[model samples]
Target: MPGIAVRTAAVLLVTVGDGTSFPTAAHLASYAGLAPTTKSSGTSIHGEHAPRGGNRQLKRAMFLSAFAALHDPASHTYYDHCRTRGKTHTQALLRLARQRINVLFAMLRDGTFYEPRTPRLT
Candidate 1:
């Protein structure tokens, strides 16, 4: 079999907890600094969602999450839905991120773990 790409959950699992142990995506996103950052420069304008301000490894994880959501069939379907709702790639990714955040939240809230049966990066 061809070599499979690495993944965020795998990394998180190794570092923190596996997919079985749920951790909020927001917690992960915040930990990764993928979450928005507020910065106002005297109303002039020079701001980004705060560039790279969290765990380097965890940030990588969110990108992996983004990539996975883009690739996974179910996630792709959701992305298409976002696109149909007039969301751009970035917008779609944000939407996907929001959804991922929910999944993570639910998993953690329920004290359930994520057990991906398929070779999923999603």
Candidate 2:
């Protein structure tokens, strides 16, 4: 929601179409091609990789939103955390997009608005 503007929101609404098509956020992420897929065969299992399928428009919207969200402190922190965890720049952005999809799903499901989390002082 941080980076989602009029055009982005329009694209998302047009692409997702009522949100009933996806049962869960995971389903939405998969549809948008943000969910990583695991490739395996016998004992020689391949690692998770970005899938080459799904709605390209939705994927592009999510990806661009994630990139634009980097300006938000929370989003920037998450991106940095992903980078520290050894995720590539693109991978981190994809992960962020997936994370945002979960939030979007919850918002759509509950008809709620975005509320930024406040950092707890410890």
Candidate 3:
């Protein structure tokens, strides 16, 4: 109302986009610039970098959401999986954001809100 980061607003906006039960998690992630960037040249090359273009506020919101994902067993497990697979903190967070996007997509498509399903520990 008074003052809030644009990222926060973006997340909320995406969550409520169109009111058709679709929030465009994928769109939100891309908008936030949380997606990875790749650069290659004749010789020199950069593997990946934080995305170059997107809404900074959305990026900040997604990053902030990463912390919350860390504490959730389901989300944390996925987050750990990304890290274990050789992703850095930033990379892992991006992966988590992507995962979150998928979840949101599914929810929107199915008309369901998040209800994390945790796998049984073996």
Candidate 4:
């Protein structure tokens, strides 16, 4: 949630009036167009691709927020982790946005605000 400015938050809130309507984070991600698209045929399945449609405003907001979140240490670590797994910069950012959507869904479900936590050092 780090880099979620007032305007971005407003866009999200407006686009997703009530997050509780989504049963799970995946559902929310799908609705926001953050989930990857899949194509399937009879007995064969194709690889996942970028989603074609959903709430464009929310998707843009999430994308921008994820980009800004790169400045946060925790988010930066996650981005690096994605890159280590062979993801491109854009792919990693999208993945990060999806991850943040999960957290946002949880917050909406629990009616809570963003709470930064310290990562325990091993």
| Best TM-score among the predictions, by candidate number | 4
Candidate with the larger lDDT of 1 and 4: 4
Give the candidates in order of lDDT, highest first: 2, 4, 3, 1
**lDDT (tens digit, per residue) of candidate 1 on 1-122:** 01114655566555545433435566666665667767677867656564557767755555557656565666777778878888788767765665665556566566776543333333
lDDT of model 2 at residue 11? 97
> Can you tell me which runs of candidate 4 are displaced by over 4 Å?
118-122
Instruction: Output the TM-score of candidate 4.
Output: 0.90
- Return the clash pairs for model 3, or none: 7-57
lDDT tens digits by residue: candidate 4, 1-122: 79899999899888887686899999999998999988999989998998989888889899999999989998888888889999999999999899899889989999888887643322
Q: How well does each candidate superpose onto the true structure, as a TM-score?
A: 0.56, 0.90, 0.64, 0.90
Worst 10 residues of 4 by lDDT: 113-122
lDDT of 2 by residue, 56-89 (tens): 9999999999999999988888898889999899
- In model 1, pairs of residues that clash are 13-17, 19-114, 20-113
Give the 10-residue window scoring lowest on summed lDDT in candidate 2: 113-122
